[model samples]
Target: MFRKIRILLLLVVLLFVALGTWRSDSRLASWAYVTRVAVYPVAADDSPTTAQFIRELDAASFAAIENWLQREVKRYRQTQQASVQIRLGAEIKTLPPGLPNAPNTLDIMLWSLKLRWWAYRQEDGENIKPHIQIFVLFHDAKRHVGAALPHSIGMRKGKIGVIHAFASPEQTGQNAVIITHELLHLFGATDKYDFATLQPVYPQGYAEPERLPLLPQTLAEIMGGRIPVSRERAEIPKDLSVTRIGPTTAEEIGLLAP
Candidate 1:
């Protein structure tokens, strides 16, 4: 009897969250003033370098993401001077909930709900709370040596993200790219890259699709995450300067939706 009652209550809570977030999703996608983003950093691995990097972080460290969004907003001719504001939140000692190894639809949905609840509990005695909460897990590249970082994820409805990034200073530029990519996902942007090949989709993913001999494209679409340099190969963007928000991505994110 107790187990049945608990299961029923859980289902009710899930339904309530779904309905509430359905409405919140529209507002978030509308580019409203409540688009403040709070970033919380966590050391994914126990390394001295990672701890130091997190300790040294400040507003200036993420300035690239801010500058990039400001530029994109102007380029798209949005009403607000800046639709997105990135700020640091209270330090989180523990890591956010991670995804299952092979998450099915139900698993993903449950994880999303748990993630949102976890985010709410993480709020400290801050005067201003963030509308979008991004938990960045930084791994020490110097000590651990070169290894592929874990995948990052963002939720459109809940406006939360768990981003895996490197703690090395040199990787900050690329980290900004991944962070911005997940940030855009929170705002309703879809990935423009092929999951199988990890290649940027043509036309929508290409920064300049109209250019002659489109192979060796110079810039990457912000949602695409790759600069196509050959038929089967692409380059990881060095910085936000080498990335652009294509029309499709802008439209999806409500930037082009006057």
Candidate 2:
């Protein structure tokens, strides 16, 4: 009886802690503030080339990401202008490739908790605490890679995420798009693409749904796929330069006037 009681008490404590963290995260996401994001680069593949690329990663590599976010934030004139500032965090050399690749939602949550603990241990006392943490896992192109399942969780304690991408320099722009996509996920933005077809949904997924031609959209919605070539066909944007935030996405992320 005593053991059961203790277990119940522990569960209650955990529930309270989770509630508190959720409330805090909600305020941060809703408020008009500069979100400080820490980007950690990890070599997911064991290839020497991937290791070399990770070694050479610097702040300059992510310049386009920052520029893209800054431009999007400025475009929203109604709401308090919020901006995202990303800093290259320390390189994680010990993390394995399958750490965050879980089989189910429960397992994913557990992995996120483990990652949060690991990140806390990696930080030095002088480093500022990040509002969001993103781990960019670079895989070697020489090996045949499968689909990426980049994800994020917004919590006061576990505001950490993972993005799997290629290690080649040519993929840097695409990596930025993935990073921004996951970053918005950390702020309560939902995916605007259809899971089955991998195409951006109607209206919300379109950059300008009112365009006369409707097909072959010039600008791709940030939350949507890159290029809406046709009603049935859409492609990923070449870089962050052509990606934009649609009205629905802007409203969901608190960038639009509520």
Candidate 3:
């Protein structure tokens, strides 16, 4: 009789623990999630131009990016009555060395754990604890730079990401677009563009699929490749001004009910 009682007690405790964990995870996924993000700049290349560009990095450089996020949240809230927000934390220094440039699945998990520990140790008490960390690595224009890990989003412990771009004043606006793209990936948004043809998909990818003439789209969907110039062609927007979140993306990110 005592053995049976002990087994029952163990099961009861396990059930309670599972319930508590589920409730906590549900709260994080709610519409009121206000995620805090920190952006850090690093010179990927050792060239003089890249070094100088990294030196010019400041909080002001990301102001437009922050503003764009605010506007997007506000727009969605007004239309769908969802109250999600993105709080941009202060710009921090580059992360420590030894982080993998091209991490595999195991490397990603290990790197995320190391990054969270490193960030917490670097905090000076004045800075807010970020829910997400974005490491922006700047490279020279001569170097071909086209790699941002969408898989790095929404890791265990915390959300972490990386963006690689050219180190030039002219590329700042375009870089902001890329940053915003990766930011959405952290919130469960998937890509809407085709990998083979690099064109935005139909219906879900189109910003205004209900329009009479769907040949030319006025705005680019945030998850899509770019604004559609034709049924089969699209062009990258110069900045976030020409980008807007589509209904599919908003629903995926919990900003709208499906």
> What is the C-alpha local distance difference test score of each model?
0.85, 0.77, 0.70
Query: What value does the lDDT take at residue 138 in candidate 3?
Result: 73
What are the C-alpha RMSDs, in order, of all predicted structures? 2.2, 3.1, 6.3
Mind giving the per-residue lDDT tens digits that candidate 3 earns over 5-100?
999997996687467445534543465655566776766767889888877777678888777876787677765333333433433455443557
- Count of clashes in candidate 3: 0
Best by TM-score: 1
Off by over 4 Å in 2: 1-9, 12-16, 78-81, 96-106, 124-126, 145-157
Better of 1 and 2 by lDDT: 1
Off-target runs (Cα >4 Å) in candidate 3 are 1-28, 31-33, 79-126, 145-157
Tens-digit lDDT string for candidate 2 (1-258): 999999999899789768856875776566577778888888886999899998889988887888888888778754555667788888877663344443688786676666666766766333578777788888888785566544433333566667777888998888888888877767767888898888988899888989988888988888885678987888888888889989898888766655
Better of 2 and 3 by TM-score: 2
- RMSD of candidate 2 to true structure, Å: 3.1
lDDT of 1 by residue, 121-168 (tens): 896577787778889999988655666788899877777888988898
What does candidate 3 score on TM? Answer: 0.72
List ranges where model 1 is wrong by over 4 Å.
1-12, 143-146
TM-score of each: 0.91, 0.85, 0.72
Candidate 1: worst-modelled 10 consecutive residues by lDDT: 76-85
